[model samples]
Target: MGFHGIAKAVCRALTVRQDGPSLYDVCDPLLLKYQGGDPHLGKFYRTALGNPALRPLLRRTGLPALKDAERLTRLRAALTAARDDAAPDWTAIGTPVAELMDDIDVRHPQPPAAKVTARAPAMADIDRAIRVCGAHLLRSFARNGFIPTYAAFNLLGDADISGREMLMALTGLNARGYKNSTLLFALARIFIAHSPARALINPPWRGIAEPMWEPVQIRHRSAYYDAFFTEALLGFVETGLASSDQAGAARRAISDMVEFCLKTSAEEVPSHDGSTVNVITALAPGPHPRFSRFFAQIKQDLGFGIYVPDCDTTACAFSAATQAGADDPILDQPLVDFYRGYQVRAGANEPRVTVPLNDHIDYEGGVVTWIDNLNGDRPYGNDLDPTLNLDILEVSFRNLKRWKIIETPQRLQTVHRIIAFQRRLVESGAFKNPRSHIYYLPELYSAYFGRCYAAFVALPLAAQRIIDPGNVFALIRARVLGYVKDELIAHEMNPFDAALALMALAHLNAEIATFTPALHCIVQNLGEGGRRGPYKAYEWNKMKTPTRILVGGPEVTSAFALMSLALARRRMAHS
Candidate 1:
């Protein structure tokens, strides 16, 4: 059929009544034609519609372009057909529909408008954010002295970020005359209680020999917690708020922890190369200078080489070495070799280095797919794995120069190549597109994007231009502003996510105006005892799932809120 003929057929099938819902919201004919009679139609629909390959065709054909009235009409019709028909060849319809739309767009060209500058934040707005974030933090502190990480219907007791949150809150509050000494004391006790006892012998198992701090209440132990708790304890000790004995004990615990990690039989230790480095880095800043032996032992055991299991581990290790004044060119050769092996060819002329978050790998049709386990092994598989490629680039860019890796021609080329890759990722919408594997939960997305903002800010002006010629930060600023606007109007975000979002904006030095509304909402939502309670967890789609699953409590949420406020205040002062 001709373009007009197909357009009429599709529009007729897709058109909704004036009072009806939007085309996307309504049932589409194409969906019925292809997906009907299938018990798993929902899954099939998402796969077909969300496919990255199909996105190009859809965009080129102008079939599903966002906010295109003509394309919406055709898409609505096709979707309705797929929904209703018992059996239909999706490829047949999709191909023809795409061609028709492509022909139309070619005939009538209408380009999108240029991007605009964002509104700047006002001083009053900054003041309001600090006040609200501070109030929310105080109100969200639990009776048990911990902060809930998320305050939603699904999560209540989860303490994933509890240690870090408490540390940040303490750091922030310590600057303001220790307004919450009771909370600080409670947190100090928790940190000390969680430290591994020096008297205990190392476990014999190869799987469990790594020495790390274990949380008091949580059963699962990870390197992330080990690094976090170590830093928190060290920070607490430095404040001199704890009793002399308590401070001394903390220092001893740190020493013992380092010794245990170093003394553990290398053969028995599982490769938590990243965590070990993090522990060393955290200890490097302490008053004690006994970590040189531990540092040397770690280098011997893990080698200065890059391990594929954790890409950022090598960077962290190098950074720690530099910080401790033990940096050596010989030690960096392994990382150099590792980076050389990890370069990805983007096009015939462009190549970039990328660091995968995990070691999960799948080979399909000669294409290697790196699986991300940021959220763990969930039913949705690797769909939620955050492609932290930009984050890796940022870490590499910020640290490699200090380690002198950038001095080599090959290494400098890799840096330039990665910067080029980062530019493409942001410009091509790979960072935010769900079709690409990099898209993550909104809060996580904000966090990663914030890293990009910070990295961009740190870049030399010339380098910044090479990485982001289009001024993408303006777009990011607009998005964050929109988020703050939405939260102010609806207040639907959980406390942890809200705090994270605030912190991300602060990292970008986003206008204070964008933060005020959300901060106000947080202040208004505070419950009694300065605690925000009952946090949410990730929703499971499995059969017979409970309506609500408690994950975090007041401790995590309160700490995060406090940290967010502190970040905002710091940014505001500088601005």
Candidate 2:
């Protein structure tokens, strides 16, 4: 049976609720329908299905399993047999996901920095720290229960502890939905080595596993990124038995993620002008129950929140250069109200344009504009003219005032100070900045100072673009996203940065699907040497170290390298 017939049966069973069909009920039938599902695929669930927790709730659809080493070997053999019956086609498949090459000519690919640079001592320290972190993160992954861990893979002698830690860190971040690490090279190796074809139909993580990151939200942006989730999404769409069912589920997952990213502004504002900032307002819950409650609690805890300008920036703007259309909206709501509010604030004679917050466009949701003179219900939106009631902004801000984070402004101040202190290291001219790019101060101080400058410069450029209050969430979310994204890009766009970015994005709102492949790439590209056995990669730092030894000081260089490792480890733990 096609997925249609099978899905219908499942849906029908659900409607009446008379003991939903068991995995055994659906598995064999679906397998038979999909053409004698591989016995290996059957065994994966046949054993697991016995568990009560997985019974009907998470059953097997008889998809093939491509997990570990031996299973993959069998799966490949099966593919060989199946392809023999049909004409084999070459030049069809693209590069393998991870390029699982055993005993292959192993060459440690260059780090992104290797492509360009004249190193100063401080930069050298930073680079060394980055590389060492990359190595350690991969090693940490081995310890975390992944198959490719150092010891499990007998990599103790071949690969160093650094490589393993980098791999593990990237993988975990990828799991959360990001590809920001330098570890992608190692991850790609895993993809080249394995396939998750069978695992797609009934994903293990289900909803959480569904879209881990926003799709095509950025376009063909990162060359190093993996489109694994995109591929998986496409697979489901194309092979789905019922266009309405499986596709519907996928859409639901997407909807949940997008909705979780947005929260309705608000309904009322208090008359602060008459008294002490009497800002008591209620904020709507977010899409995800717990997250929404947490958000609401934060708002209530804050006692006051700033009203940022609301705007939508999820759609693309037409550029004569690209010759693309004005762009379809990627957000999930109407942004008319926000735009109308903007028109009103700008002193347009009257609210000329009205847009609905309910329309299918996303709006920015952070930083409400503080209009001390604004208040009142003022018939916000009518069907004829949709517009966001600036009243909602009032309510939103009041709720935010109650947020727990803002309540502890002292903590925020402390963190800010720490970031500033770390940023001022540039003052001593520690790292040679030909363009004075590192303006903050020195060391960590310089890094964060530059980061702050980047964020400040970017804010209004993104914030000012907001046209509607409904799309406010989309804009600021994009801002927060852009901030970290640029940071990752600054670091030569490595797997490590990707992980951190993913974590930040997930915290801001919903997770998406683009992170997995990027993670797989990191796992596959891990550097080799220890027990994986003398892969013959030259020491990049060692070359510079010996040079520094004669020109500068040996003891100092040795201490620097050691410090680099220590710093890298600390960074890995934090990131």
Candidate 3:
């Protein structure tokens, strides 16, 4: 579809403000569309920006973009150099991908002070690791009490930025003359704890002694039951139960099928025997229905995060991670391989060129077959094709990043408070549930979560205090720089995750204006370029293909948009 088509769809999908559409509405879809065959949409975008009537409307809507588009262009050249290293020919005067990434990191380096490196899709395990790591830091500080990192009770000191993204953003801060690593490290360390998981792990149950029984953070304490805020954060409260049996049940189910398949694979043709018939049925003649069932079960098992019974609190106040015992049997690889030759192609076709083994597709024919059926043998970079993976790579970093900050910026003691509560549950055997149990999620245990507001606010504040964060005209250049960094990094990421990062970063920027009033200009200046990308029909479809399975989740996208809106409203009111 054309740009207009996407604009029309967006208008239909979201309820724009009574005053007009939000800046997100004005820009997100194109950024969401990012790539594909929609030149008409690009043309419309250019025209809309140029038009006299729409220009102000666009400006008034205010959005984020790169601070230096030209600088970003240079950054992209560096990023390409780095990415090319992903599959470098060492014989051709080249460095490996990892080293090149390090080099690029150095070239566009964020000043070093305190540092932490993390991988994507922050799973449950990472939580505990941080907690354990924090324990070491805490032990050193327990003798003298820990203090909040900011040392500023004034709300004026506040600005939203993710711990990691904001760390990288220090380049902007350094340009403005705030050259203190101790301060940034103190802030960076504080940045780690801003995750929703803290809602559960570090609940203030002692608040129960007060007139209000609910967690201390909630706006309505007495009105809402005890642990209400806890429930709001973690989806449930834990009673300290181990989920070994439920895990065993799921394991047994998979093991039985795996055994049957292993035995069946011994025989050449398919069997009608009952033992081997669990995953296969003669009704469809092909195993597609059976495969569908397998897929469903896999999702169910992994997604089955059970809620534990409440201990003088709301239900689901302390939920446990979906249990999977490592010793528990794994899926039957042989059984999984049964479908490898289910549909043999007539002739041998050369393997399609991809981003060099991007994923180890144990079961290949399926993803490609699905892609080909959607768009036939579109040869490698046929000039018409951008050849991108269409699967959603879900990300969960911002929530996790927000976890460490609950302590005191440096006060990891917040995690200890949470562990104390969990220990009570553990000793009292509150965690003995047959189906769901609350074990000490020592990893996820932290006091607070990291949040992002738009950088629009601080840019001008820094401008006034020391230097021009960016001139009114120069701010867009920075946004362009940011987008190139984001999109280039996204090359290695699944498109879905990439889209999510963009949206999250955009909302973060939008929020910044709330804390610093002058930021709205930065917000208005960068316009859509700060937060958007070129949306095209083909690219949208490819990205959406994986999203279709999860498409019913409008909640995720809407929540993100709401965050951006919250930031916008806050900024507007203050401005």
TM-score of each model, in listed order: 0.41, 0.20, 0.18
List per-candidate RMSD values in Å. 20.9, 25.9, 26.2
* Candidate 3 wrongly placed segments (more than 4 Å): 1-323, 326-330, 333-336, 342-346, 349-575
**448-536 per-residue lDDT for model 1 (tens digits):** 56655666677678666654566655665556445434432234444455556676777767777666544543444444223223221
Instruction: Give me the overall lDDT of model 3.
Output: 0.22
Best by lDDT: 1
Q: What is candidate 2's TM-score against the reference? A: 0.20
Instruction: Give the range of the ten consecutive residues with the poorest summed lDDT in model 2.
Output: 542-551
> What lDDT would each prediction earn against the true structure?
0.35, 0.25, 0.22
Q: In TM-score terms, which candidate is top?
A: 1
Order of candidates by TM-score, top first?
Answer: 1, 2, 3
lDDT of 3 by residue, 383-423 (tens): 01101100000001111222222223222222222223233
Candidate 2 per-residue C-alpha lDDT over 1-575 given as tens digits, one digit per residue, 9 for 90 to 100: 34565465455333433232222443344322344423323332232223343234234222123334564444344333322324222112111212322322223122242122222223344344334433332232234211010100111111211233233222322111111111222322222112221122221221100111111111111100111112122223333222464456544432322222222222223232242221211212233122235434432332112222122111011010011111222221222222223222123322222212111211122112122224432221111111112222212222222222234544233223222222232223322221121111012122222223323333344332331223433433454455443333233323323333333433343233322322322222233223331111111111000000001111111222222223233333344
Please state the error at residue 558 of candidate 1 in Å. 5.2
Off by over 4 Å in 2: 1-248, 255-283, 286-575
